[model samples]
Target: MSDGIPLIPVIPQALREAAHRGTLIPFVGAGASRLAGCPTWAQLADGALMACITANKFNHGQMEQIRHLSPRMKLSIARAIESEHALTIDYEKLINPFDGYQNNAVGHRVYRSLGKLSKTFVTTNYDAWLDTEILDPPLSVSTDSPVQDTVATPRVRRRIANVEDFTPANLNQENCVFHIHGSLVDPAGMVMTTRDYIRRYANDRGSDDPTRENRTLTFLEVLFQHKTVLFVGYGLEDLEILEYVIQKARQQFPSERPQARHFMLQGYFAHEYELMRSLTQYYAQCDIELIPFRRDQRDWGQLTEVLEAFAEAMPARAPLELQVQMEMESYLEP
Candidate 1:
C-alpha cells in the first residue's frame, strides 16, 4: 500500500526515511477530522448563519443572498452579527453535531497512525479527534472514577500547545500537538473568519503586541526549514498560508530542491493525472511535492491505509502505554 500503486517508490521511501529519523511532521487539516463526523468550513459558516437567523440578526432572505459566498466571508458576517447582537454561537456543537463523534473508528485509526508517524503534529482544525482519549485506549484509574479517567487521559503524548506557544521548548516535547488555528479548548480564539485569518497570520511588524509579531510566520519558517512535512487531508483549496510559507522557504533556503522536503497526499482519479502536470510544476516551484493517491471513488476513504503504511514502514514500535499494558498482562495470571 505504501510503495507501488498510488505512491511511487521514491515518495514512500522518502517518507520512511523521515519517519525513522523522527523528523516527519504531519500537517493535518479538516478532512482528517471530517472522517470522525466533524463539519466542514461550509457547515460551520452555515451554523453561524443559523445562529444569526435565530437571533433575528439575519433573515432567510439575507441567507439566500449570501449563500453563494465563501465560508470565510460568511463567518466574517457571522462575527459581525455576534458583535452587533451580543449572541454567542457555540462552535464546538457545530463542529460535532453528532455526539460522541470523537469515538469514530476511522478517526481513531487515523490518529493512531499519525501518532506512530511523528512525535510532533500540527493542525488547523478545532476538533479533539487527534488528541482526545475518548477514541483512544483508556487509561487505568481508581474504579470509582471511570469517567474522570476517560476525560483526563489523552491518546497521543499529553501536551496541547497553541500557536503562540509554538516555542523551541514546546516543539521539542515528545508528542506535543501544535494547534496553529486554535482548538475547541478555546472557542473564542479559533481562527474561523477571513478577518480572523488576517489577524492570526498577518505580519504586523509595528504592533503593540511585541510577543506576537511575526510569531506564526517564524513558526512556519521553523517547520519548513527543520522538519520533513507531509501535508495530509488538505485540498489545496486554501492556498494562502501554504503558498506563502513555501515561497518564503524557497528564498530563505536555496538549494537544488529545497522544496523537495515537503509532500502533500492528494487524492485524484487516474484520468485527472494528465491534467495536474502544470499544478505539479507550480507546487515544485513552491518547494512542495504531491504524493498523488488514486481514488476509486469521490471520497477519500483510503487515506487511513496510506497513513498506516507510513507508520508501518518505520521500525516496529508500540505506544508506551500499550507496551506497559502488554508487559503487565503477561506477568499476571490470565
Candidate 2:
C-alpha cells in the first residue's frame, strides 16, 4: 500500500484563503486525474511501448532502443511503433488510456466537486474528463459533442474557442477550463513528444497560434492582476513552468519591492515543497506564498471540506460568490 514517494503537508491555511477569495486559479496535472483512475504519464509511456511491440515493426531490439525516451520524448516511441503516423500513434495507443474517465466513482466525485468549486481550470493532461463533465454534470464533460468539430485528421487539432457558448450569461460566467496541452479526443490536441514541449513552451511556440498566443498572454495577465495560482498535479519537474511563474512574479513586482499580491497552490508532495522554495528564492523580489495540500490525508472528501472552509472565510468577492452558488446548485441538484 505504501508508494515510495514522500508525503508533505501542503499549506492548508492559505488554500482556505484562496477558496474564499475565489481567486484561486487551479492548474491541475496528471496526478490530480489519477485520483479519478486515469493512468499516470509513466503508465501511458509503458502502454506506448507495448503498442510498439504489438505493431511488430519494432522487435524487442528496437523497443529497447527507444525505451529510455521520456514520456515527452514520445516521438521516439512513434518511430518504434508500427505506424509512423503521428495521429495513429497518438490515437490508437496513447489516446485511449486518457480518453474518458477511467472509473465512475472517481470521475463523478472529482468532476462534481470541480463543477461546484472551480471557475477556471488549466490541466496538463490530455483527458476529456472536465470537458465532458461541464455540460452533463456527473457524466464525462469531454465527450459532449462540441457544437463544431473541424479536426479532419488525427494530425490536426482544434482549440476550444471560449466559454461564451457554455457559460451562462446572467451568471457572469468568467470561469472556464483551459486544456493547456490539448485533449485526447481532439486529434489536434496538444499532446506531443519531448520536442513538442521544447517547441511549445521552451521555444515560445505556445504563442505561435494567434489564439493560443492571446490566451497564454491573457492567462498571464489575469494571473498577475489576480495574484493567486493553485498548482495541482504539477511536480515542479517542468522547469519551463518554474521559469514562467518566476518571470511573471518579477514583472508584477518590478523593483526590489514586494509583490502587491501573489500566491500558489501545490499538493503536499515533498518535491513540490522544495520546488516552491527554489522558485521563491529565484524570484526573491516577488513575495509569492504557497498553499499546499495532501489529498491522500483523508481522500478528496476531506480536501473538499477544507477548500469549502477556505471559500467561506474569503472576504466577500461578489463575482466568485455568484459562480460558487451556480456550481453548488448544479452539483447538489437531484
Query: Which runs of model 2 end up more than 4 angstroms from their true locations?
Result: 1-18, 75-87, 90-102, 132-172, 202-218, 244-288, 293-334
Report lDDT per candidate: 0.69, 0.49
TM-scores, all candidates, are 0.80, 0.61
Model 2 TM-score? 0.61
Model 2, position 258, has a per-residue lDDT of 29
* Local lDDT at 72 for model 1: 87
What are the per-model numbers of colliding residue pairs?
1, 18
Following a full C-alpha superposition, what root-mean-square deviation does model 2 have from the true structure? 11.3
Displacement of residue 259 (Cα, Å) in model 2 is 6.4
| Candidate 1 overall lDDT versus native | 0.69
Pairs with steric clashes in candidate 1: 259-287
